[model samples]
Target: MGIFTRSIVSRKPNESMRLIVTTFFGVVFGFLIGLCFPKLSLTKFSLSTSILTAIDFKYTEYTKLGPSSSTHVSHPVGNNGSSANVTLRKIWVPSNPRGAERLPPGIVRAESDLYLRRLWGKPSEDLTSKPKYLVTFTVGYDQRKNIDAAVKKFSGNFTILLFHYDGRTTEWDEFEWSKKAIHVSVRRQTKWWYAKRFLHPDIVATYDYIFIWDEDLGVEHFNAEEYIKLVKKHGLEISQPGLEPNKGLTWQMTKRRGDREVHKETEEKAGWCNHPHVPPCAAFVEIMAPVFSRDAWRCVWHMIQNDLVHGWGLDFALRKCVEPAHEKIGVVDSQWIVHQSVPSLGNQGESLDGKAPWKGVRERCKKEWSIFQTRFSRAEKAYLKEINSTSR
Candidate 1:
């Protein structure tokens, strides 16, 4: 017997070990062969048809085969070829709900071309435009005789508004000749007080330009037409002619050094002394020669203190009003005008004697000074606030 068969038989001489040993050996051998050659064991296994029937099997037909008969299926072309079972879903690809529709590249270029063509044509016939100019002035006792003369010499197509303290009865009666020229008179208690009242109603009227001056100022080599042309050329809002002092006073400055002082004083003080940023030296001499644009007139008219007791504050009033408004106030070098400075009369209560008249005038000046102080302080504060707010 083989050694394996002998061992098995010897282990159980009185027992039925043959079947047990045979089954054990078969299981062990099959496992070893399966690990070594897996395909061989499956190919070797064949069950009878009865063995498949012994197992419980169930099958069911589908009521609906989804998308099986859809349009994507490829029909068999020939008997030799295989047919592909494909189904295409009728899905709606979402529209561009939030996306911008792209415009054609040439649309912008076409629009630009059309715009250029339209703009190239001549403008509409309805458009009407013309140059406008307005003239204005203030007159006092000294200016009464000369107002008509100045007006006649400087008159133009411009509308002239003349303000006078000496009433319509004076030498300004000839101004009535020009319907465009208006003469407004103020109550004649004091020249300074009345001058302030003259500015209100006249300034508010609508005009493209305004020219204010004392009538005593004489035009020398100044062409109003040429001056207006320059004004328009430079786009200046406020302009004054270069003033040569009628008194022919030379300007001189004084200097002080250690242990030595140099003084150059003139009895002839013409107008106010010109500073660097202030009006030019010429403007100072010709106080009556300033010409204002409509905008400047409007701004300056509001700042005038009509109740001011004296005429001393007019320059200060002008500087305050014009400087803050960002309007240009410049001296025209080409034009020239002369100022005829006149002395002030003493107060109504004073006698011509040195004691009474001087005292009364001094008292009046003090009263006017007090009024100026109050008004200037208030105006300055308001002006500063306006400027600061504008800057912000």
Candidate 2:
């Protein structure tokens, strides 16, 4: 009975030890199988989420889809002996939209065919802005060198119109700077004739001043910018530069003195007289270089009779434009141009009916002066009569 009892106790301990050893070996074998075939799944165990993310990151080439691969990836696809069911997707995106229409004359309106533009280059409903000065010169082929030098003096703020009398572009177009000027090469017409035809008062009403200059001027000492500044300062409506004293100065008012701003009144000698209506002390400038104000030019353009192309009798009668002609019409002494006195145009006077061109021109000048005097007297009497009748 004692021996059987001892045997039972020893058998029970041995069975317990055998069960523990079997359990440890089974656990070790399962862990080894899991490491070898990581993708393999069982009903009881699943793959680690960190391991799945690391695998996805390693295969994706780090394309930065949101913050993590799991953010855009679908549900973990089961590998049931078939290919993994995977889906490529983008994260959430916001919408982009256009703005509202508020303003008129939009791109569509401006591009419409109904638009009428006022621009000289391309007409639109837009108004035009005119330049400060309109400078016209009657250029001959022989005096192109002089014109080149004169154009250099301008600051390029004014418009230059060149009327070519000789009508040859070979000499004038040879200069590189002539491309900037508006060259009008016409045949058999004088400067005044061209002025009458092209430079109508209403067309040039946009400019503040008009410069009708001759071609034979030496502008070595002259600066157009400074001349404009001085003209505005002196309040001159009709003005010209003082001629070089040594050159041909028929009128004393146009003579350059010893560095003065202006010379409106010349001194009277024992024999000379200062007439209120005459030049030298009155408002007058030579035709060689005359700068007229817009308002004054409007008046002067009307007084220039259509038949009187010589422009003689015009300088003396310029007081009709501005009443206080002496104050408004004076010579600028600060900036002066040299009259080259080149006789290119002077020698071109021709007569078709056996009379010399110069002789015809001279005779016409004398006749125009006489006619202007008679016309002035009639105008003055008419004005007086009107004033007297109005007073009554």
TM-scores vs. true structure, each candidate: 0.46, 0.63
Q: Distance from true position, residue 169, model 2, in Å?
A: 3.7
Candidate lDDT scores, in order, read: 0.50, 0.73
Q: Candidate 2 at 386: error in angstroms?
A: 4.8
Tell me the deviation in Å of residue 17 in model 2: 99
How does model 1 fare in lDDT? Answer: 0.50
Flag clash pairs in model 1: none
Off by over 4 Å in 1: 1-134, 137-145, 168-180, 189-198, 201-205, 246-275, 278-287, 322-327, 344-374, 378-392
lDDT of 2: 0.73
- Name the TM-score of candidate 2: 0.63
Q: Candidate 2: which pairs clash?
A: 116-124, 116-125, 117-123, 117-124, 117-125, 118-124, 349-357, 350-357
Model 2 per-residue lDDT tens digits across residues 174-279 = 7765665677778656677777877777667767788888889888888888888888899899988888888867777788876688777675443454575457
Pairing residues by index, what is the TM-score of model 1? 0.46
